[model samples]
Target chain A: MPKTLTKKRMIINIIISLVVLLIVINICTVTGTRSISLSNVLKGPGLEPGDNIDYEIFSVRISRVLLGVFVGAALACSGAVLQAILKNPLADPYILGISSGAGLGAVIAMLLPGISLSFLGGLPIAAFAFTGAIITVSLVWSIGYFTGRSQVTSLLLAGVVINAFFSAVIMLMTLIVKTEQLRSTMYWLMGNIPEKQESFLLLSCGTFVILGIIILWRISNNLNIITLGEYESKGLGIDTEKTKIVAFSFAAFITAIAVSLSGLIGFVGLIVPHAIRLIFGPDHRQLIPLSAIYGGIFLVISDTIARTAFGQEQLPVGVITAVIGGPFFLILLARYTRKVSLMK
Target chain B: MNIIEVENLGFDYGQKTILQKVCININKGTFLGIIGPNGAGKTTLLNLLCGLLKPKTGSIQIDSKSIESYHVKELARKIAVVRQEFVPVFDFSVTEIVSMARTPYLGSFAFPTESDRQIIVESLELTDTAQFADRLLGSLSGGERQRVFIARALAQNTPILLLDEPTSFLDMKHQVGIYDLLKNAQFRQYKTIIAVTHDINLAAQYCDEILLLFPDQNYKFGSPKEVLVQEQISKVFGVEVMKGEISEKIFFIPKGNYIKNNK
Candidate 1:
C-alpha cells in the first residue's frame, strides 16, 4: 500500500466515525414521545410556547440520554484499556467485581435506617456505589500485585473471588432487608436513570470525560506494546508493571464513576469495544476514541428506545440494552468461536 | 571500546537456577552470536543484558554506564531488542508496528514526525517489507512476520540491536535472507548486533564472535575459528563433528551425516 493511500484511508475512517456519531445522535434525539419532527428537533425543542414539552425534552429526556452517553462511553473506553493491558478480549468494565461490590454497598446503605441522616435525602446510592467500587478494585489490585505474577490470569482470578464475596453480601442483604427497601434495591440493580438535575449529570459526566481522556491519551503507547505480551513489551522499553498499574487504576476509576451514575448498566462496555474492533481493527489509538463515540451513540439510542417505546412507563435502560446487546454479543461469540475452530 | 559488558552475572527463579556466573563483553559494531542447546541460558543472558531481568549478583554496563542507572527510554534510544514468542492481540498495520520503534524519541502525546515516517519506510524497505506496509501483522506469514519485527528494530535505528532466536521458526530461505540482511546492516550501517540462536552453522557463517554455552557450567567465547572446533563442539553439545572446515569459509559436518557425505 502506498503511503498516500494509507493516509487517505485513515482520514476516511475519521470522517466516517464522525458521520456515524452524528446520525446516531440525531436518531436518538428525534425519536421520543410526543413525536417531535426532525426539523423541530434540530431547530430546538423550545420553539413551542404552552406545551411544557421543552421541559420534558431538555430536562428529563436529554439529561437522561446524555447521562447514558457519558456512562456508556466511560465504560467502553475503560473496557478497551483493560482489554489492551490485560491482552484479553473477554475483559470488561465490571470484570473486577465492581458492580457486585457497589450493589452490596448500596444495599447496606439502604438497610441502615439511621444512615439517612448522612445522605440527607433517602440515600446517596451513587456515593455508596462509588465507595464500594473503589474498595473492591483497590483490594483486587493489591492481591494481584502481591502475587508477584503480574499476569492477566492472577488479576482475573482475584477479581472472581472478590466478585463472589461481594455478591454473597448483596444476596444476604436482599434476604434481610424490608420490602420497601428491597423494592428500591431491586430497582437500582435493574439500572434505571432517574430524573436527575442537569447540573448533577453534567458534573458527573464532565469528571468522567476528563479522566477518560487523560487515561486514553496517557497509556496509548503502553496499550500498543501491551498487546504484544508483557515480556515482549518490557523488551520494547515499556515498564510493564507500571503500565499495568496505571491502566488498571484508570479503568477501575472510570468503571466506578460509570457504575455510580447508572447503577450497573450491563454489557455496553463488553459489547461496544468488541464491535468496534470488528469494524475498525484493534489499534487503541483508533480503537479508544472510536469506542467512546460508538458507545455513547449506542447507549443514547438504546435509552431513547427504552424511554419512548412505551407511552407512560419507561423501560429500565438495562433491560433495553440487554435485549439489544445480548443477541449482538451472542452473534459475536459464535463468530469468534467458529473462526477459532476453523483455525484449529 | 566495549559497548556492553556483563560481569559475574547470575540469576535464579526461587530454587531453579537459570544462569550462573556469566561474563561477556560486546564491542561497538561487532556481531556476537550466543549459541547453546536448549536450556543453556542463551535467551536468559540476552534478557539480562537487555535489562529485562536483574542479575542475582554482579552488574551490566552499556557504554560504561551501569544499565540500572539508565532510564528505560534512555536505554531504548541506544539499544533495541526483538524477542521470540511475541504475540500481538491487536491487528496493527506493519507500518504502525515499525513506527513504534520511534517511541523512545517521542513525547507523551506526540505523533510520529516526518523523519520518523521516513525512517520507518526505509527500515521496511531494508527488510523487504515495504510492499506490506499496510498489511495487518496478524495476516502475515511467520517469515514475513519475522522480517517485520526486524524492520521494527531497524526503524529504531539505534547503535545496538539484540535478537532472541530470530530465525527459529523461519524457513531456510528466509533464515539465509535474514542473515544476509543483518550482515549487510552490521558492516554497512555499523550496528552492533547480538543474536541468540541454536544454529551453530548460521552463527559461524555470519557472526564475528560466538559465545558457546554448555549445560555443565562451561562456556567458550571467541571467534568462530576458536569456538566452532571439533573438541569444543563435542564438549558443549556432546556430539562429535567428523569433519569441519575453517579456512576461507567455516562449515561443519556432523558424524554419520549421509547428506554431507553425498555433498
Candidate 2:
C-alpha cells in the first residue's frame, strides 16, 4: 500500500523539488563545450559582444536551461491532466496527435519556403507547428465528442488515426524535399534544444504555460473526481463535460507551445506524472504542481546529458529522453502492473 | 411528505424504449429497493433520478423542485450516488478518495475546511472504513473498496443516496454486510436510500419499499410484501419462485427444475 501523504511531508517534498531544480539549473548552465564556472555566470553578460566569451556562453546556456524548464513543465502538466480526463494512464500530450500535426505543419513549411516569409526574423516553423497542434486537437475533440457514447475512447481512437494520417503525409513530403531541406527536417523531427530563441517568444510561451498550469491547479480536485469515470464524476457534481472541455483545451494549448519551442520531445510527459504519482501519491492538487516542478528538473538533467555526453557533436535532446526515460518508465510500468495484478 | 416525485418519466436509446411512463413518489428516509432482471432499465431509472440522465418525457422533482432546474453542484449536495465499480488510474488512499466528496462544498481555492474534515472522518467511522483510511484504495479487498466508496458517498453529506447494483459482485457475506451498512445509514443518518439490485430476497429483507421493473418500461412500485409477490416475480423474471417468511420478514427462493423433479 502507498503511504498517505501528510501536509508536512508534501510541503517538504515541494521544497526539496524546488531545491533540486535550482541545483540542476546551475549544474546545466555551467556544463557543455566551454565549461564556464558559476562565478563567471554570476558576473553576467558584458556590454561588448564577443569580448566576454565566458559570460556570453553562460548566458546562452541559461536561456537554453530556462527553455528546457518551461518546455518540460508544460508537457508534464498537460500529460497529467490528459491522463486524468481521458482515464488512461498511458495518455500523454502527444497522444492527442499534437506531435504528428506539428510535424506535418513543419514539413509543409520546409517544403514550401514561401510560407516562411510571413514571419519577420523569427522561426515561422514554431508558428506553423503551434497552428497545426491546435487544429489537430480541435478536430479530434469534435470528432470524439459528436460521434458517441464512450467519448474518451472515441477521442483516443480519433487521435491515433489522425496521427497516423499526418505522419504519412509528413513522410511523403520528406521524400520530395531537397537534401539540405531534408537534413533540416530530419533534425527537427529528431528534436534538438536550440541554443537561442527570441526572448519575446520565450517570455510569451513561459507566461502562457504558467497560466495554464495555474488554471489546472485551481481545478485539480475536479481532475481527481473525473478520473473515477463519467457516472461517478457527474454524481460528484463535477459538470464532467465542462471540466473535460476546460482541461482538454488548456492541456492542448500548453502542449502546442512546448512542441513549437522544442520539436517533438518525448517521454517527459509520459514518465514524470507516473513517477510523481508513485512517489508522492495521486491526489491531483499535489500531483499537478509536483509533476510540473519535477518535470522541469528531469528535462534539465536530460538536456544537460544530451549536450555533454556527445562532446560537441550533440545528440538531440529527444533521443536522450527516450534512451533514459524509456527504460525507467518501463520499470515503473512493470511494478505498477504487478501491483494491479496482485490486487486481483 | 414526498422527497422525490417522478411523473410519466420516459427514456429511450435511439428507437429502443428503455423506460416508459415510470412514476413514483418516495418520501424522505425511505429505503427504496429497485429490482429487475437484465435489461430492465433499473440502472437507467436511477441515473435519471440523480440527474445523470435526462428523462425523454415527463418530469422529476427533488424536494418539489424540478430536477433540471438544480445546478449540478446544488443537485450533488442533495443526492449522493455510489457506483457499482470504481477503478481509478492513480491509486489514492481511502481518506483521499472520500475527501473528494467535499468538492461541491469547496470554494475555488479553498482546501477542505474543519467541518469538511470532520465529515470525512465521521463517514469513515460510520462505514467502518477508518482502519483502511491510510491504505491505498487498490490495495484493499473488493468488499473493503466497496465500503470505502460507500464511505465516500456518506461524506457527501447528502439527504438522499442512490446505488446501482451495490453488491452484485460480492460474496454472500459481503453482500449481507453491504445491505446492513445501507440499512444502518438509512436508520441512523435518516438518509433516503434508493438501491438498484438483482438480489430480490435481500431487497425484501432490507428495503421499506420495492420497485420491480420489467422489460418494455413497465414497473410495479409498493411495499416489499406487495411488490415481491411470488406470481409477479415468476412472471417478470421468467422463473419459478417460492415465497416464505423468516423471523417475520419475507424471502423468496427460486424453484429450479432440479428441485421440482426431485420433489
Candidate 3:
C-alpha cells in the first residue's frame, strides 16, 4: 500500500481510468427515466435539438453527466490538496465549512426575489455561494491563526465551529420557507443534480474547474514537500505560507464552484482521494489526476442510481452518495485506525 | 576563511529573550556543534542561521553575503538541514523521500533530471541506504531511517549542513554510526556542518569547534577543549560532572545524586 507506481504504470492506469470514466458517462447518459438508444445518442445532436424530444432529453442528460464529471473531479482534487496542506488524511473540502457557507448563501439567495448576474450565467445564487464560501474560509483561517498554536489544528477547529453555526442558520431559514419552496430548498440542501443548465454557464464553470485542477497539478511537487512539515518545507526552499495559501485558495475555489453547481454532494471528495492514495500511492503527481478521473466515474454512477433506482420517484444524488458513502467511510475509518495502531 | 558570520545576533519570543548579542564566525568545511541545556535556544539559533526565522536584531552573512539577501531556494541550495526524526505525513519510499532533496532545484513543470537522479543515487549509496531505496521510510528501523534522512541532506548538495540532534532516540551503536557518517561527510565532501546536540561527547569527538549557549542569552564559542570547562558545564547544566579523556577527546559523566548515594 505504501509503494509507488512507476511513471509508465501511472500513465497506463490513468489512460485506463479515463476510458472507464468515458464508458460510465456514456452508460449513465443513456440510462434515465426514459431509456434512449445508445446509437441515436452517439449520433451528433442536430443544431435544433429542441424539435426532437429524444435529442433534447439526450442533451440535457449529457450536460448533467458532464456537470457531475466536473463537480466530482473538482471535489476529489480539492480534498487531495486539503489533505496535503492540512497534513490530515481525513480533510476534505467540506471540512473547511465551505459547503455549509455555500449552502447558507444558496438558501438566502433562493428566499430573496430575482437577483441575477448576467455575466455569471444569470445565477446570482452561484455568485453568493462563492462569496459565502470565501468569506467563511477567510474567517476560519484568521480565527485559526490567532487561537491555535499550529495552523493545521486551529483551522480545522475553526472550520468545525463555523460549519455548525452556519448549518443551524440554514436550517432555521429552511423551516421558515413556505411548503412550495420548502421542497426545492430541502432538495437543494440534500444536493441534487440539475436536470438542465445554460450551456454557456456549464462551459465557463467547466473551464474554471479544469484550470483549478491544472493549477493544483502544477504545484503537486510543492505539495509533496509541504507534507513533510512547515519548517521542513521552508528549509527545502518552499515559502510554506505562500504554498498553503495557494493550495487552500484553489482547492476552496473549485469546491465552491462544485457546491454552487450541485448543492452538497458529500463523499466524492472524502473518499476518492483516500482510495486513490491507498491504491496508487501518495505521490501527488499521480494522486491528483487519478482522483479526478475516478471521482467523475464515482459520481456519474451515483447520479445514475439516484435517477433510476426507485420507480418514478427521483432521489437526490446526495442521498445515493451518502447511502453509499456512510458505509465506505466507516470502513475507511476502521482501516485508518488499524493503520495508525500498526504504525504505533 | 569564514563562510558564516553572525554579529550581534539576537532573538526573542514576545517579551522573553532567547538569545542575545551572539557573535560567532564559522570557517568553510568546519564541523561546528551547538550544545546547551534545554531552553538555551539551540534550535532557535539553528533556525535563525538557516533563515527560517528572521532575526530581530543584527545580521548573519553566509559566504560574505547577507543571509537575508538569498531567496529561500537560493539559501536551500547553499545550506541543507536534517531535523530530528519524526514520521512523515505520508509513507513515501526511502528513495522517494531522499529524492525530495532536489525540491530547490526543480522548476515548476520539471521532473528530476539525470544529474539530479545521479546525486540522489550517490547520496543513498553514501549513507548506505541504497538497499532500502524501494522500501517505505516508515518500515525502516530508527537507525536506518536516520541514515535515509542524512542521505536526503546529502542529496541536497549544499556546502553547509545543519542537523538538530540527529542522533537522539538512538542507541549507542546508531549514535556513533550517524556521527561517523557525518564525520566522513565532512572530511570527504568538505561539508560545513553545524549540529545541535545534547551529546557533548559526540560534539567533542566530531566537531572542530563548539558553541555553548547559556540560558541567560550568553554564549561561548571555541574549540571543545577551550569551551567545555568543568565550572561552566556545572553552572550551565545544574549538575556535577566527572570529565575523562581518551585518545585526546574529552567526555563527561554526570555524577547525579543517585550515583553519589549508591557510593
Report, in order, each candidate's fnat: 0.44, 0.61, 0.56
Better of 2 and 3 by DockQ: 2
Which predicted model would earn the best TM-score? 2
- Candidate 2 chain A weakest lDDT stretch, 10 residues: A113-122
Per-residue lDDT over B9-108 for candidate 2, one digit per residue giving the tens place of the 0 to 100 score? 9999888899988889999999999999899999889999999889899999999999999999999999999987665777877888888888889875
Better of 1 and 3 by DockQ: 3
Question: What are the per-residue Cα lDDT tens digits for candidate 1 across A269-308?
Answer: 8899988776666667667777877888877877887887
User: Which candidate model has the greater TM-score, 2 or 3?
Assistant: 2
Q: After TM-score superposition, what is the CA distance of residue B137 in candidate 2 from its true location, in Å?
A: 1.8
Residue B239: error of model 2 in Å? Answer: 1.7
Backbone clashes counted, model 1:
0
- Cα lDDT tens digits, model 1, B12-39, are 8788787777788888999999998788
lDDT of 3 at B236: 91
lDDT of 2 by residue, A1-344 (tens): 12444456667877888898899898888878777766765676677787678888887788899999999999999999999999899999999899998888778777776543224433788888889999999999999989988998899999999999999999999899888778778877887667788778788888999999999988888888889888888888888878888999999999999888788898999899998887667888889989998888888889999988978877888898899998987888788767655644
> How accurate locally, in lDDT, is each candidate?
0.78, 0.87, 0.87
Candidate 1, fnat value? 0.44
Q: What are the DockQ scores of the candidates, in order?
A: 0.37, 0.54, 0.49
By lDDT: ranked, best first: 3, 2, 1
For candidate 3, give the lDDT of residue A239.
Answer: 80
